[model samples]
Target: MTPPQVVVVMGVSGTGKTTVGRLLADELAVAYAEADSFHPPANIAKMSAGTPLDDADREPWLDAIAAWARERVEHAGAATSSPYGVRGVRGVVSCSALKRAYRDRLRGAGPGVFFLHLDGPPELITERLGGRQGHFMPRTLLDSQYADLQPLQADEAGVVLSVAEDPESIVRKAVTALERAAGADNGSGQATG
Candidate 1:
């Protein structure tokens, strides 16, 4: 059987993951979720205080998002238990899945957990972060994020897109690439675009 699809829009902060993810979800008519919403109050407070969360701090947050992803998969045509509460077999989510281990953990959500990695130069991301407002994550944490990021390996089922492109262009390219991957897989469950 062909597995249900879940596209993970992943990158460090200020990489436009949320904007592009929402656009992609809307264009594809799939449910959308923000990884930040899965974070606990303590995690928010820690980041608000300019403190970078250690692995333990992010464990619960990642688990919550993974749970949501799995819920979307297992429910298939049934009503989703997520905030959208819609009946859909597909989903798009924005998450800073910097490390390989974290992405692997998220993959447990389903067989079709494909990732869309957004990346750009440090200076570009830093400027974007500086201009961004109302976010708990501090720009100072960007260095740590880059340090921890492990780009997708050749064997991983995913694609890397540049953040330097405009949002509309990026969304268009992402949709095209992911669709091509979906059609090319032939029920093999390999969706690397």
Candidate 2:
């Protein structure tokens, strides 16, 4: 039996991580978790007030998501062992894992964990941020987000997709990348054990 694939859709604010993540989850018939929903209210307040979140503000949230990912993988493993159980389930999470360390923490959860980096030009991201209604992240902080972004390394187990593309295209690209990665891993007979 094969293990489930977990994908972390990552980018700075207004890069459409949540929207694309949800759509990707739907297309893959998997579970979708929004990283923002796990954030503490204080962190949201800080960002809403045009204040950037320091490492201290992000530590707890990142830890929570990592734990959640681990738990999901464990649950899927258990279910797959049952005689009448469903096939393994995939997990798609939307997060602003701006730093390499954050992405590493997520990868530590399990093997076959992929990161999908959604990127776009600053001008486009700023426009999207401005157009968003009632979002906690202020447009004033878009610059801060751009400043904090760290591009994923070539060796990372992930794909980079352009947010400037249509949302449907972005979703298609992400899902296809994940499927191909899963196929490769399965063919190689690697286990997440």
Candidate 3:
């Protein structure tokens, strides 16, 4: 079996990060975390007011998530076997790691921090965002998110999937691609999946 790792389902809001992350966690049989859960109330309030979060405001929030990832990865190392008899822990988390720097901060938690970026055109994302309910993120903030989004660099260990496909198809591709990558690399990003 491949070694444990954290898969961060990332994208701008309304890209189905949380939905796909939950499904992926179930399929991977690992812990699932919502990025918003790591945000401070102040951050939520800011976004609720249609305000974009600058890096300074995100520092603590990112730090909190990073700390959680570290703990999860650390505990994973100590686990001889999981309930599924796996060797270590794996986690699927939904985070809007829009900027490369934010992703780098997450990687600081440990190795094997893979990113699964969900991307699509603004028109589609705008539609989805409009349909979403009970969410702090306003559709007005989407532009700022798109502006801040940095596509995955060549050095990063992750894949980017388009949101043009249906949710199930996207999730299926993600699972297949991630597993293949793990198997091909022995959990390293040395070869194509």
Across 1-193, the per-residue lDDT of candidate 3 in tens digits comes to 2343788899999999999889777766778999999999999999999999999999888888888888788776444333334334478889999999999999888876888899889999999998999999999999999999998887787788888888778877777666555655443442222
Angstrom error of the Cα, residue 157, model 3: value is 0.3
C-alpha lDDT of all candidate models, in order: 0.80, 0.76, 0.81
Tell me the tens digit of each residue's lDDT in model 2 across 150-174.
Answer: 8887657777888878888997776
Model 2 lDDT-worst window of ten: 78-87
Tell me the tens digit of each residue's lDDT in model 1 across 86-158. 2233888999999988988898887778788998989999999999998999999999899999988765667
Candidate 3 global TM-score: 0.88
Q: What is the lDDT of residue 2 in candidate 3?
A: 36
Best by lDDT: 3
Which candidate leads the pack in TM-score? 3
Order of the predicted models by lDDT, top scorer first:
3, 1, 2
TM-scores for all candidates?
Answer: 0.88, 0.86, 0.88
Which is superior by TM-score, 2 or 3?
3
lDDT of model 1, residue 156 = 61
- C-alpha lDDT of residue 6 in model 2: 75
